[model samples]
Target: MKLEDASSGSLGPVIEVIQSILNQTGYILPALVLFIIALAIKYPNRLPGTTDPKHRPGVYFPPGADPLIGHTRMIVGFGSEGQFENFKALSDATPAGSWNVSFLGTSSMTFVNRPEYLEYIQKTNFDNFPKGSQFTGRLGDLLGVTGIFVADGHPWKTQRKQASHMFSNREFNTWVRAVIHNELDDISALLDNVTAKNGPGKLILPELMFRYTLSSFAKMAFAANLNCLSPDPDSLKRPVPFAVAFDRAQAIINDRFITPGWYIWEKFNKTGRDMRSSIKTIREFGLDIIHKRLAERQDEKKDPLAPVEGTKKEQLKKEGKDLLDFFMDLTTDPEELLIVVLNFIIAGRDTTAQSLSWLFYELMAHPEHVPKIRKEIAEKFGEPEGGVRLDYESFRELPYTVACLHEAIRLHPAVPKNGKAVMKDDVIIPQGPNPDNLPPVRVFAGERVGWSDWVMARTPAIWGADCEEYNPSRFLETDEAGKLHLRNFGQWKSHYFNAGPRLCLGMNLATYEATAFIAAVLPRFNFEWATAAQGQKSAWPPQYANSVTHPIKDPYLVNVTRVKA
Candidate 1:
């Protein structure tokens, strides 16, 4: 046969076979897609590990959620600024304050916004719910894999046991108070310089608060001065490398919570690169601090009494060393030491600073409360004469001042949301009598449970009718003697520093630091929103920056006028 004819004869059958297969696939493709859709619709809850709708009859699943992604779009849609709006809406939609939804198809999250459920999860059945891989996987790089924040079970227990000393030690706490005072001197100097240079309100209080707390924490934890709260005009304008990197890393880490397949994209994306660079800066700074301490420790070992001890104060200082000293005694591993110290930095720096920013913002917005706080401060310290100095004992006397702090935290919790993974199939029984009449919801192993203190802070059932209002009075009571006392709202209701075993290690220190600033500063200087006071109302509920902690968003400027003695 001719070459062309021979080729055509051989190719014809193969081409026909190919054509037949393509034609069949054309019909089969649509049928397969339709079948998958129908299957999804029919058995939306039929996945191997999802909670069946029938099983969670009491829970509200927000409508318009994709069968696969569930309410993930609601989470990932908004930037950090509006991140919690959807959660607020969801909380409002379900009066009972419990909801179940999936994130990446198979992974499920059960939210318990009620305070009682929080008590059950955090205290009653604490062990069943660990922080889980979902949380550790995202935050591990920045927070450290074995850090106190990420550790569970025995490691957590051991870390907690050792770390508790800083909070509980009388002498150490006194040192922390002294450190806060020293840092405040820098803040005061900055405020004076800024107001003099640019007039009142040149200072952004949140930024200043972060700087103040970073400096305080560095001293209190590491005994190394970062000088983060420098008064220099140029320094005020420029970001501190360690502080900037720490905050940036946390903000980036917050993104991973909502970004689907974040791991895959983060490996190749600018955001991921930025996060790594930030973390590297943090790690290097941490290691540098660790190495210096190790060197000093070795020297101390060489000559036990080389550093001469002075007075009672010096003895106490030596007896109650900083957090780094405490951890250095426990382990010499630089990485481990860095992890624990960084975890406390989050507690010392971010939580206290953000809490104070929110507290002061509310105080500035509602100046009516400022007088009450000042009045309480004066009552406790006897008129701020010669500038009142607060010791550890003094903090206990300012119940009203502490109440105001608690109230502000209730409205704007630093750590707004937290969760734990369910170890096995279990049911959550609402605490109290279940006023909302919510039924028990069953959770399977591998699923996670979460609580939004931010939403709970606004829930009427939890905080009463004036939940949205910035009312510190809700956390207080008037005695027959006409004295204001803070009512114990318990850990679950307050829920800012958390509750039970995982309760924030630095809660006492945080309270002391923030209240000291408020007591000392508020008594001496008036903090007013410079622009907002000029007839423009600040946002009714202050907006927050999306970070590991909920910080007041920008435009945090405040005028600091010295209160007449």
Candidate 2:
């Protein structure tokens, strides 16, 4: 009887524990199974110990990528400062000049740094790879449906054709030149005033360059003077509304690139709200310009042969029209006009401004080149009594100046990387230092591919050991007669302005503007870093804002002194 009582006491607690576990298992089992199934569905190839045999055998990835999340943890961990560093690390690890990275599960991004891959994607398989919907959708709010930067297929082709005509027009080019000259004159005046107020004062060159480019484009495209660089008391107090809206819109749009499932985030978060507000501001600003331009056009039509009212309108003739007038003739849709004008303004403003800023940065960093450029400019254009006379013809004559611009662009490309979406299954055969002798990489449909011009321009294998150095003479060659001439590297090998059918349409205009602006300014001012500015060291390889155009990360400040005649 004693033994039976002892057994019962032990058995009672054991039975109770068994029953409790059984009851919990019923609920827990289903959730566990569901979680496993979700992982299987999302990352079938990513399960621990299971490798994807389908990927190019030599393709590499960062170590310790989670099966469920892939490289997301590492990428997110890097934050902003280390984002490009992560890419550089991957490139260094691989011998194929490419690497595969996954954000979550099987969703992957293949980064290609090979020149051959760039050619294949941009030219050989142009139709197969496109600026896919994801890219266009992300930029849609800012660029609109018709803007060439975000457009694809038919729309892109149509806009490119029309824009080409506008860009190539003699009258339009003349008007652009006039606008550039006027803006430069204003910049000179502003600098003079600053010098008078605070002798040898520090000037933020990037900000000044932005104002110059923005004001030039505003006058050329919108027939409105932003007076962005003006020292006028009225202009100083009130900022240009369009300029502010444009910058805000650009920042918001660029943020979408890093925002995962951006479409979803845009729909359900503060980012969406901010983007909407910026879009609204941009739309309203554009509409105001369009309305004003339409009224002006109507007035001109109502009274043909009447003398044009403003200095800007003088460029408009009954036979030849500026871009705004041309687009207004094509479609009265205010939104469409806004899209076209904004596209031009964004392209013309950012790229040129960033390019000039970097050019000056390089010049200040290497002052020895300044005298060479100035001497070249003087020899070609001749120093006038007042200042340099910069026209289209004279702009092209400065071979050394052009080479310097090219070198600067190479070191600091305005657009550092270009991306495309694989529309169909494609194979890329990478060239240059295929150390592992890797086979072609098969990119499945819907996969993303990116190429870094910045990387290619700096790679030792591609451009030789001194690729990182800012040597303007690299673009120049001496003839048998010992006279130096510009070597035409062309767009394909350079890739600075991109390549193939979709090459930047504003290349000529941008080149002309940069040349003119530099010519006008370099002859008059001696530029160097301010003592305080010098103390602020820019990060090597130069940090960049994650914008469509990767502008310099920090403000570049310099002191400008007028050159004595």
> Can you write out model 2's per-residue Cα lDDT over 57-120, one digit (the tens) per residue?
6676667667655666776565466555567677767765688766642256788876667778
Candidate 2's TM-score reads 0.88
Output the lDDT of residue 428, model 2. Answer: 85
Error of 1 at 556 (Å): 1.2
Every model's TM-score: 0.88, 0.88
Model 2: number of clashes?
0
| Candidate 2 residue-wise lDDT at 280 | 84
Each prediction's whole-model lDDT (CA): 0.75, 0.74
lDDT by residue for model 1 (419-469), tens: 889998888887777767876767888888888888888888878888998
What is candidate 2's local distance difference test score? Answer: 0.74
